[model samples]
Target: MAKKLEYKDLLAAGVHFGHLKRKWNPKMAPYIFMEKNGIHLIDINKTLVALDEAAKAMKGVVRSNKKVLFVATKKQAREIVEQVAKRTGMPYVTERWLGGMLTNFSTIRKSIKKLNSLEKLMKSESYENLTKRERLMMERKKEKMEKVLGGILEMNRLPGALFIVDIHREHIALAEAKRLGIPVFAMVDTDSDPTSVDYPIPANDDAYKSIELIVNYIGDVIEEAQQERKQEKEAQKLQAEENKKRAMDEGADLENAPESHDEEE
Candidate 1:
């Protein structure tokens, strides 16, 4: 099981920002630091509440077998999001979001199917059946096909929910989710508005460590729910097998029962 994130851990992550040691120009500091208006940071209470809500919502989605999409536009957040997806077994968008990935899922799925077919054909050594030039042409075609469908293949299906590292850059994805009535969870820095998201966990989105901490926390919740479901399934299967054995044993006992001795008289 993954450990719960603590306030101290978050504060420790903030230390990574100390690299901004160079004298801050009034113009640059505003962009570098998480701030809005005169405020430099988000309220701790709000962040805590948001984190709790997001974690609970993630657990619910995992238990219900809903798909969750992790999105990140920044390099640092992208790395963290990728790690989170691996940990939680969820789909993610580390590269740019494809415009109609969710709305036009059927088309994307078809493309993915075609890519799979091509892959199988290439692996079948059927190339030997073709002339040298023909084989080279086929190989080039395969490479182009893979590049086109690479991102689509990463996604298994439309996401039930979305977790975005940056709300602004990933607005298209967020908007699609809203139109489809899918829930969204995101890390809203001080400058970003949290109202758009269903569950907004405010934190230092610019800090690599801070982003990782939040992503890992949510991933842990998802993993825990998955484990719980797996255990429940195992228990149910065990109970079913035991019941079958008990029924069989009772039937055998009945068949072996001694007949009434009254006939001996």
Candidate 2:
């Protein structure tokens, strides 16, 4: 579990800042601490609660051996989200959200498979057999597809959960997750409605520091859970080996035991 962040920590990271007064959402009133300088200040306590909820939910997904897809296409969040997601080996979408990404998952899977087949062809001897024009065309198609689907190429199934940055901007992704019954964890800014999200962390979504801080935190939690899972697997392997050894030793002892079998002597 992550250490509880103090008010100063959130403030320093600029997570307490909100949008302009004119852009505030009424549904966010519960999480608002106050208004200062025409900007709505987020309630630090609520932020803490929401952050804990989102972190716990994300950790739960990893602990259950389920995948959580990260989505953040906004300029400020794109780099950080991609870096953290790649490091964690989780799927991410830093580009435009394709409609029906969840609803049309089967079709999307076909495209992913096509990308994989193209990559195999590119590496095979058959690639050399093709004409130069044909090879160039294939390369162009692969490059374009990779830009859209590369991060999620390894994903074979719909994610167990979706962690989104800037909920307002990624509403399409959120809606898809909601329709599919996948849990959603998002950074809900003052202008965004928190009601739509399963777990909402109300904070400054526009600040790079805020996005980086939260994304890295989630990444760390995922890495930790994965490490724990590895250790468990190793422990199970060792125990199985010990059990096997014990069984063999017991059998050997029984065979070596002198039986007072009616010795003819």
Candidate 3:
């Protein structure tokens, strides 16, 4: 089992409500309070079940080596998404989601392949051995192209599941995932419709602290799954080695028995 990341630790890490607190939006107060206090306004029992389901789904994804797309449109969400991605070693979409990212994954993969090829070429002796001025020019050109293809290159492939911070703003990505038959897990705000998502974690999306807490929790689940997989592999290897040794020992015993049989004859 993975070590649980405490909510207090996340708070200590300075996950707080963003500038929206000062903004005059009556609709945002509930979310803001929920975030600050790490409270879930929804049914606590149902929320626990939902979290467990999400964790199980995440485990399945990790077992299958499926990619998860972490997305957020708001500034706080963007930060939380980045943290989640970093912790889980998954890809994220902090910037806007490109149209057809899920449906047109092959094209995006090709772009990633191209970028990899270019990166390789740039690192090769032939490229590196060029005149200083020529190398600098080539690097500059590569940087420009990389910047242009940043979004596609960052993702490089379709995600098996989508994790969104703000479902309302990232509706297009969710819709595309639905169209492509991908599962979605999101931190749904009260004003947002939870029915749209496959796994809706109804919580305070407005509060930076709350968002970070939830995202971090999910990220911890993924890391735990990864560690479990690693341990399983090690155990299999050890079992195989033990079987091999046992087989050798049995063979030796059989060989000795033959000598005893010869003596009896």
What would the TM-scores of all predictions be? Answer: 0.77, 0.89, 0.71
Better TM-score candidate (2, 3): 2
Q: Least accurate stretch of 10 residues (summed lDDT) in model 3? A: 16-25
Between candidates 1 and 3, which one is better according to lDDT?
Answer: 1
Best by lDDT: 2
**Residue 149, candidate 1: how far off, in angstroms?**
4.8
RMSD of 1: 6.0
Between candidates 2 and 3, the lDDT winner: 2
lDDT by residue for model 2 (65-97), tens: 888899999899999999998998999999888
Per-residue lDDT of model 1, residues 1-265, tens digit only: 7586666776777622322233222422332435444346444555666788788888888778787888886888877787778777787777777677778778878878887887787788675688889878878887776654553476777777888886766889888888888899987665455677888776777888888888888888888889988988899999999999999999999999998866665
Model 1 TM-score, all chains together: 0.77
Question: Over the full model, what C-alpha lDDT does candidate 3 score relative to the true structure?
Answer: 0.71
Show where candidate 2 strays beyond 4 Å. 1-4, 125-136, 254-265
Number of clashes recorded per candidate: 0, 0, 0
Candidate 2: give the clashing pairs: none
Clashing pairs in 3: none
lDDT of 1 at 136: 88
